[model samples]
Target: MLKRRPLAVLLGLALLSGCATLGEGGASRLDLIRQRRSLRCGVSGKIPGFSYLQTDGSYSGLDVDLCKAFAAAFVPETGAVDYRPLTAPERFTALRTGEIDLLSRNTTMNLSRDAAGGNGLSFAPVVFHDGQGLMVTTDSGINRLEDLQGQSICVGSGTTTEQNLNDAFEARGIAYTPIKYQDLNQVVAGYLQGRCQAMTSDRSQLAAARSGFADPRRHRILEEVLSKEPLAPASVGGDQRLADAMRWVVYALITAEELGITQATVQRRYNEAKRRPELTRLRRFFGIDAGLGEKLGLNDDFVVKVIRATGHYGEIYNRNLGPQSQVPIPRGLNRLGRDGGVMVAPPFQ
Candidate 1:
């Protein structure tokens, strides 16, 4: 007493179900980027060495270079990036709402952000290893964290820096007053006006702020690091393909440095690799026959474009935050792992 449907109807129903699944899955962000022919990257343009808006109305800095590298990899034209400058409080929301395709600001990765604060976002590999620190006029004679026991500190509101400052001070049982401001500019103004005895933020940011002071020599960033800050780019979660592509783009930069590849040598080496069968790994990396880039839904020569645009990791750092730049923070923990730092790229193969 059972009835069977026609084969045609059954096939049609199965096809409809498959179509629903495909629609629910949606197009990956990568596909969207290719279709749109551009990548929207979020950045905090206030910081000098990380992401700064120049007087010429152009953006430059470490984070900016990363975004450019990403754009070169994702877009048809090399270095085609739409940079959206966001504040500390606005960065995450902008990313979650798809106002920006990627966030390449100096954002720290932590448990709360990776889980709760991100609202279903995932961070890429760590690009910069930083720590919270304080800065004060040398005249203040605040050589260490304890010296600011009773002093008021100028901090930016709605940032991890403010929270870390409080936690560090409380942990040492040191009493201090916090003068919170709405933005980095306000915090800097408060410190300059002597409303607070010291300014606190990530060490790199402190150095950048000090460099802009009328008399940069007057201030000094203390050596005391309050908390670990692993700065990285971020993207919306739930798309493993997009996440892997973003992560590998960062990894390619680091790997290029490890492999003794630089922008200056990239072209020469690429040409040389073709003649040498011994350069199989290099050939594979350049997509001679290996389909690594295709597997990731990208062109095989994506890494070449990335390097040509942004250079290697060390080169990017040198161009933005190294000794030649306005903020010359030493690459202590940011050096490659083989060189005694934590920056190790996974094997490309």
Candidate 2:
């Protein structure tokens, strides 16, 4: 004979299953971003000019600008954003657990991340192009990476730069000790405090950290760049809509720069472009309706807000990290395609 469950027990089981389903199908990442009222962005806690926290408890850097740009796109009038400073190890998990809407940290995009090597996530566009390098004290008598044999090197954990350092040294049969830290600040502190003889990270990061030092002239960044670091934003996997929207945001920035559209000119020229079909279409590229923003459950003006708030790609880059910034990193390979760099945007139309 079959034993029937009590009515209360049966009801409880039914309710539990329903709750499970509801939780599983609750909302998409896009919906969450909208409902949250502000985009939660993960960034480096302290990387100096790249992604450090400001005195006002806000963030300002190339990576920070990108996050703010996306948030402004989502909410134009408010331009609201929640910047979460995450260490290298915390960034990936935060994105995966939906603790953050995006990872705008100074993270390098590589095959492992792109391939989703069991982490169940991937990168967006290559927002900033960077390469790994080593920095040491000017008086260390070491001018090259090859000179660091049997020396101690400081690097961050859960970062590509550390692995690159190990691989480069091993390939050349050089011996060294890796003093791993969580982010650039600790790596810098370690080197500055003589805990390590050399500090290794992305070249732009090295420059940024050096610029923030008490005595910038005391340290020198080596000339040997080891690896190609396509620094970009990241989002968790299984959300095609969110991923596409984020990807296109980056593309739009590049496109705006390539199309010679600055924030100052976007509005003035947008009205004039209304008379020209090509210009109108180009203006629409920034999610100006036509179903792009709608597809992502965002207002049509989302991208326009991003461009207006942060300017086009070149404007943002130059303003935050280029000649105008304190660090003054040269836009070497970051130039537009016409200038022999890899930056190019697809036709907005």
Candidate 3:
């Protein structure tokens, strides 16, 4: 027999355990944003046209813009963005360890990432729809996917590209080996060094990589797309409320663009936004009463601020990768609702 501990001691121990769980578990993405007055986003350190550090300590690219938009939506001040660069292997770990509140590094949304036993990361919404493809030296005469048979393909390790390539080749009974590298630079270096027959990744990444080569015309991207990659922002766990806020923030941008509301117009139409019923509903979503921000531990105007700061989804894309930009990624499947693509936003009502 053993003597029982004091009731007060047992109660105190229980409280401490509960507090421990609350400290980490209770901390939501919005909570972190409010406390730190910024949004901590995880991104790749050197992925050009996606997420890259600029000369002035600022992040620039499509992914970086999205993170900035998120921060603006969660907080009015556009400066409330703390960009944390991460690697392919470190992205999910950083989220799970609470080092970053969100992942916006052109990460593809897939089952393994959201699975409980896997990366345990949940997606927000599909921002960009891309596909895997191959890029080879134009002089090499590799023009089609079938040409990759028996060829060594350069690919990044721990990415969906590996499985996508395998699946495509397996279906056609073609045998090929993949030379996986830890970074895109290494993959490009190997391809340049004559170690790889071809390189494969999302077409956008392939394009970005191609632009960085010594001779852009030396390589040409294959026309065949292997898989549907719905690249999206991600967070750890299935926190529905937090995820919903972020998801709709993306939706709001799409909707705003569809409605032709530009960032420059947000101020002039400020009262118009207040008067419009649909806009009013959006305001509440961003926390104009209903204690929504308090519920998420964020400021009331978080979403509003994001919109005001970033314009909308269309603006973000066009600014970073549209026909006007150097990358010029064609908007294939990212068109708005009723525009032949599937970028429909649910009504805030």
Query: Considering every candidate listed, which one attains the maximal TM-score?
Result: 1
Model 2, residue pairs in steric clash? none
lDDT scores for all predictions? 0.85, 0.78, 0.77
Screening candidate 3 with a backbone cut-off below 3 angstroms (N, C-alpha, C), the clashing residue pairs are 72-306, 73-302, 73-306
Ten contiguous residues with the weakest lDDT in model 3: 18-27
Candidate 3 structure quality by residue, lDDT tens digits, 1-349: 2345677789999868844643565545676676677888898858666777778988788888888787776765544788898888888778876788889988888889888777777788888888987888878988777777898999998657799999999998988989999988899899999899898888888878776778776777776678998899998776766787787678778877766768887655556656676766555554553656555444665556666877778888888777656565657578786777778887644
Q: Which candidate has the highest lDDT of all?
A: 1
Worst 10 residues of 2 by lDDT: 18-27
lDDT of 2 by residue, 25-140 (tens): 53578777777788888988587657877799877888888888888876666778888888889888687656888898878776677674555565788887888888888899
- Candidate 1 lDDT tens digits, 42-138: 9999888899999999999999999998888888464578889999889877876668888999988877787743355688999998998888888
Taking all chains together, each candidate's TM-score versus the true structure is: 0.78, 0.73, 0.72
User: Each prediction's Cα RMSD?
Assistant: 8.5, 6.5, 6.7
Off by over 4 Å in 3: 1-27, 77-79, 134-200, 214-224, 275-303
Candidate 2 C-alpha error for residue 206, in Å: 1.6
TM-score of 3: 0.72
lDDT (Cα, 0-100) at 6 in candidate 1: 79
